[model samples]
Target: MALKPLGFYQRLQQLTLPAQQAFMAALCERQLPNYALYAQTTGCGDTHALKAVLDLVWEQLSVRGASIDFARQAEKLVECEPPADDDSFGARRALDVVVSLFSLLDTLRGEAPEAVLDVSRTSRAGVRAFIELTEGEEDAQRLALLIRDHPLTDDENGFQDAVLDAVSQPLNKALLKDVRRLGKNDGVSNLGLSLE
Candidate 1:
């Protein structure tokens, strides 16, 4: 069955805090390449800042009670956001990556229990946007169904499921490493963009 955002959010709320952090971190890792590619193309954003924030997220998960300054990481992420006026499709995707990282940081700081849901929704939205842009399907209802059936959407849901399963187990260094591997999805993003 396809994963629904609301259902996914409800499940996320049931997990332990560390588990949720791991889940969000995995998703952010998968999305990071989006920003990297955008930065490579436009020279408009910093992939390093985004990578630092994600690294901090994984660290927070691996070291229980790790004192990460989430606010400071967020400041760095804000600097990496694509400009509001850069209306290119790639720019919008880069912004989604930034926003997903921010949501992950917010979740870590305990400022937004719902932030994981935002990250999930944003990832799905990025898939939908990609489908719409590439396919040029203008009908809202048709586009919604198309997105639901798209291979990229299926891959996104499958990746999330794998991460959720991995994180549901007891936390450990091995588990964290495996979760990160799952997030990497063999260095390919949900949109099928390779890190290479």
Candidate 2:
């Protein structure tokens, strides 16, 4: 059976963990090793690890939604240390992954308001903890600064493209191709549902 075109929000909700992970892998420019680490660390057993991360993101969004200061949360994100077992490059580029995730979420904000709010509702602490586990070396910090400085584009495609352009890694580019493919009218059918 083939998956049909549902809107982004609906599609997101309908996707299984492996599918969601593939979506995230494409969206976040993640490679296999790091992707596995994220899955393992975040507990991708019955659920998507990124979904849990989204919940943490929702926590920050909720605070921001209240028209309050969320700088403290941002500060905490930078302070986090990557997990020791994660020699994965994804851990090294954790900041980039996070920025991409937030950018992607922000793009779909209007179309999936309830999911956004609900997903973002989980405590920021979990995401923050994950951020810490990422490699926070100087290069990662510098890239993070670049991401932070760049303005988020108005449209989803534009934002995704801009992020992809900003990070010139082969894996990221490959994954983004999938991301773009998934965003199209009948993109869902193209997804590689099996977990790697």
Candidate 3:
């Protein structure tokens, strides 16, 4: 027999806390390295930069308990709902970061496979740092050595700009496209929150 449909809220409800936290953790893990690269290249070396998104997701999921559901919160985000209180600011930022990163990920997946490889390679040290932070791997010295050994020389600046520029517009366009798509699809999409 055909199954009945499930709305986004219903789907989220079906996810036990372990499953929800696991999904959130995986989402956080997926971006750790690339964001580490972005932070380092942009000269923001603080590891907290890497944790920002994860912290927000945790706040939404754990701190808020089951009340602040991901789909409901995401709906608020898609609808551009104003912050109901101080904490909502964190929620908004969390939504923006996830949506933006997810869009960039899509672009990297479909358009610039080479960039994805380059990111993986270039982010080696940062990834190690991330691992050390999250997993207690004790690789700080190695991460430092890796960074010091390969400073961005003058000759590489042009290549760096070329690589970065190629993805800039596409990233922005993807974010806009997703916002529009998610906004249009909210409450009506075939796959519910999974449509994101």
Candidate 4:
């Protein structure tokens, strides 16, 4: 979303309760496509929008004691939505976007819930992934830490090395590229939201 006109994504970072409630009303009605389009054109964070949309969907279903099926729902909303050119490339591209959105929201669960809620725009599976991670034991934490300690952007396997060399803070050069690059001034606009 930040790559698009992500104003809403940024606003979500500081969204008010009343604003959230009001948005939820519209979002719950499955009218999120409009807002999603707006967010996309604005080059904002899709992650933020997906999170909100997912949350609204979860609330509606959970409140009604409904069965939640993210995979089936993902197919209906995204998979079956044929691309404009009837090309598989577009389908793959769209699927990639959905996957990216889900992955990002899953990452943000570590953030403050309010802040995360404002910036996330994930689906049920994404949220459930986040929830599951939160419920993990030391094993999970250790695995995540391992990933954070390493990235694939350094050495011969700079990216591979980083992931294998995962460590705690005091991030090393091997993992420098593994961390957030959005904050850097590399003569290119950084998204600044890589996995940490």
lDDT of 3 by residue, 11-122 (tens): 4334443333323233334334343343344443333533543444444433424333334333332333223352332233233334443333333224422323333233
| Global local distance difference test of model 4 | 0.34
Model 4 segments more than 4 A misplaced = 1-9, 16-67, 87-196
Q: Candidate 3, residue 111: CA error in Å?
A: 38
Model 2 TM = 0.26
Candidate 3 versus truth, CA RMSD in Å, comes to 19.6
Candidate 1 on 16-112: residue-level lDDT in tens?
A: 8778878888888888888889999899999987888888888887886889898888888889999889999899999988988887777777768
Query: How accurate locally is residue 81 in candidate 4, as Cα lDDT from 0 to 100?
Result: 34
Per-candidate clashes, comma-separated: 0, 10, 0, 40
Q: Model 3: runs farther than 4 Å from truth?
A: 5-10, 48-196
Candidate 2 collision pairs: 58-120, 59-120, 80-132, 81-132, 81-133, 82-132, 82-133, 82-134, 83-133, 91-135
RMSD of each: 3.4, 16.0, 19.6, 17.9
lDDT of each: 0.85, 0.37, 0.35, 0.34
> Which ranges in model 2 have alpha carbons more than 4 Å from their true place?
1-36, 39-65, 79-87, 93-95, 99-196
Error of 3 at 139 (Å): 47
Model 3 residue 49 lDDT score? 38
lDDT of 2 by residue, 158-189 (tens): 43334333323333334444454443313211
Ranking by lDDT: 1, 2, 3, 4
The lDDT, on a scale of 0 to 1, for candidate 2 is 0.37
Task: Return the lDDT, model 2, position 88.
Answer: 55
